[model samples]
Target: MTFRRQVMIILRRDLRIEGRSGEAIFVTVPFGLVALFLIPLALPLDIELLARIGPGMFWSVTLLFGMFITFRQSAAESSSQQEQLRMLGVDPAARFVGRAIASALLLLIFELILAPTMVVLYAPAAIPGWPAIIPLALLAAVGLAMIGTLAADITASLRSRSALAPLLVAPLSVPLLVPAAQGLESLRTKNGIMVPTMFMVAVVLALAVAGVVTAQPLEETT
Candidate 1:
């Protein structure tokens, strides 16, 4: 198969798997909602404080969801599964591209739905402009997807790797989470997304490069 075709095939397969299972709806979305719901109960009920913390909380929940999806998706590729794919002559590069695409697509969908819900739940004083968030969210999703996928790949075969995956991803994802959180906060405060959005674009580029370079190594290790 052509490289692009291989990537598309895997992408479609992952998407189909996710769709038929309704895992995103039943598991992922509900998990996010539960996390979000707990924030109010866990923290003080001060409205202004909640509003101020809203953006940070929103991205934090997204991060946890991103990690959850990564861990689950990576679990799909057990050692036997990797051997099967390799025997079928799947290119590691194409596999990475396909996984990154599916991961980002799912994360984007989650954020799109969750963002509005968060606005309604916490930001009652002002409706943040949705347009400004588009570029930020898009870049953030891709960054999270790529980073999480790579982390999952790295830890997939190790003993206790399920427990290890998030630890590996957390530090690498600092660049992603920090900028996104700050940018969202900036959006809330200054109504501007240009600065942090630009930083996120850079982050996406860096992670994309890292994904490409590491895909083959990851597959080999798996």
Candidate 2:
């Protein structure tokens, strides 16, 4: 099959599984929302303080919860299933892209649901650059998805993957979390978001390239 076709096929298959299972929406998303909701309760009831720190909290929870989605995507496919794909001539790069795209779409939905909740609970002051949040969220989702995919693949064969995957993903994802948190704070404070925003874009591109290039080798090793 053509690379594009392979990617589409894999994407459709993963999405279909997620649609039937509702793991991302029904399971991961609720826990993420609960985490978001609890942050305010843990902090002093300072509305201004909550508003100031809310974006950072949102990104932090997203990164934590998103790891589960990516790990599950990689772990759901059995050895037999992977061998079946190889037998059917699926390109490793295409498989990686397809899975990453699916994870990104799911993470985007998670972020969308959390964003308004953050706003409602924290009541961050309105700012002129509010619209910029859309792209920031997109960039963050793609970056996290790519990080999680690569991490999952690296630990796919390990018995301790559930513990190790987060270790691998968390440090690598600092670039994504820091910029996303800072970008929103900058917007709230009326500071320009160019630097952090561009940094996040660059990180996402780098992770994408790394994920595609390592797909074949990672598949072989696992």
Candidate 3:
């Protein structure tokens, strides 16, 4: 099969499984919402304070819960299922991209739902720069998805993968978190987002390259 075909098949298969399970929508998203809802309660009831910190809080929650979405599908796969894909001659790089894309889509949904909730709850003084917010969210989603996918792959064979995956993902995801928070803050401040936006793009590109390069070796090891 062609690489593109392999990617599509894997992507479709993963999405189908997630759709049926509703783990991302029903489970992860709610927990994320709850987390976001509780943040302001923990802080002083100062609206300005909440507004000022809202963007950072939103991105922080996203990075935390988004990692779970990346691992959710992979953790559900059995050894037999993985071996079956290998037996069918699926390319490891294609598998990597396919899973990353699926994770990215799910994370995008998570971010979309949380964005409005944050806005409603925090009510920041400045209107969000939707023009910048849209692409910033997309880039953040892709970057987090890539980080989570690679971390899941690295820990796939471990008995402690559940614990280890988060450790691996969180530190590595600093590049994504800092720039994403900065971009959102820039939106509020009317500051140009070029530097942070470019940094996020670079992080996504770097992760994509790293994922493709390491996929085969990781597959072989596992």
Candidate 4:
């Protein structure tokens, strides 16, 4: 099969497996809700503090939850002999892209479920131009997906690797997350609107490129 076709086949198979197992939602959704719920409880009932920090909290939680989910999802490969199958004929680059795409889709699903919950629990007034939040969410999720997928691929096999994915992904993710928090916080503070968007876009593109480039090594290792 052509390389693109092979990649698509891998994506389809992963999707089918996730659909059958229902592990995708089971893993991401609950954590997302917990994240939303915790923000309120952790901070004192000060409305100002909650409003000031809510977006950063929500974004961070969503990104983190997505990373954990992606790690588990990608690590599932080791549970079977699929890694060996890919070792033979598969183009490692294509496989990496395919896995990244699959993880992005899962992260998107988690965002849809989590964002509204965050808004409801924390109140939408905290975020100005609340409808414009979609781009921010998408940008953050994509960045997380890139970092998470790459980390997952790298750490899929070793018994302790799953624990390591977050350790690695989180530090690499801060550059992306800081801007995301700033962007959302700006929306909250009614400050400059453009800064976060610019930073987020840059981080998103950079992480995507890094993920694709780094995935090859992990693919070979797997």
Candidate achieving higher TM-score, 1 or 3:
3
Model 1: per-residue Cα lDDT over 116-175, one tens digit each: 888878874563574676777788888988988888787766788877888887778878
Q: In candidate 4, which residue ranges exceed 4 Å CA deviation?
A: 73-75, 124-128, 188-193
* Top-lDDT structure, candidate number: 3
lDDT of 2 at 181: 78
TM-score of each: 0.90, 0.94, 0.94, 0.85
Clash pairs, model 2 backbone: none
Model 2 agreement with the true structure over 70-113: per-residue lDDT tens digits: 88743368888989998898999999999999999999989889
User: Candidate 3's residue-wise lDDT over 1-222, tens digit each?
Assistant: 899999999899889889889888889999999999888888878988998888788899999987799999533567788889889999999999999999999999999899889888887656655567677789989989888998988887689988999999999989988988888667667787898888888889998999999999888732
- Cα lDDT, all candidates: 0.80, 0.85, 0.86, 0.73
lDDT of 4 by residue, 1-222 (tens): 788997797788777777876676786679778878877887788876775566667778876777876776533675446556565677766676677777778888888887777767766464447656577777877778778777877677678886787899888888777876676567667886687777888988887777667756655542
Cα deviation of 41 in candidate 1 (Å)?
0.2
Report how far residue 200 has shifted in candidate 1, in Å: 1.1
lDDT of 4 at 163: 77
Q: TM-score for candidate 3, please give it.
A: 0.94
Deviation from native of the Cα of residue 5 in model 3, angstroms: 0.8
TM-score (C-alpha) between model 2 and the true structure? 0.94
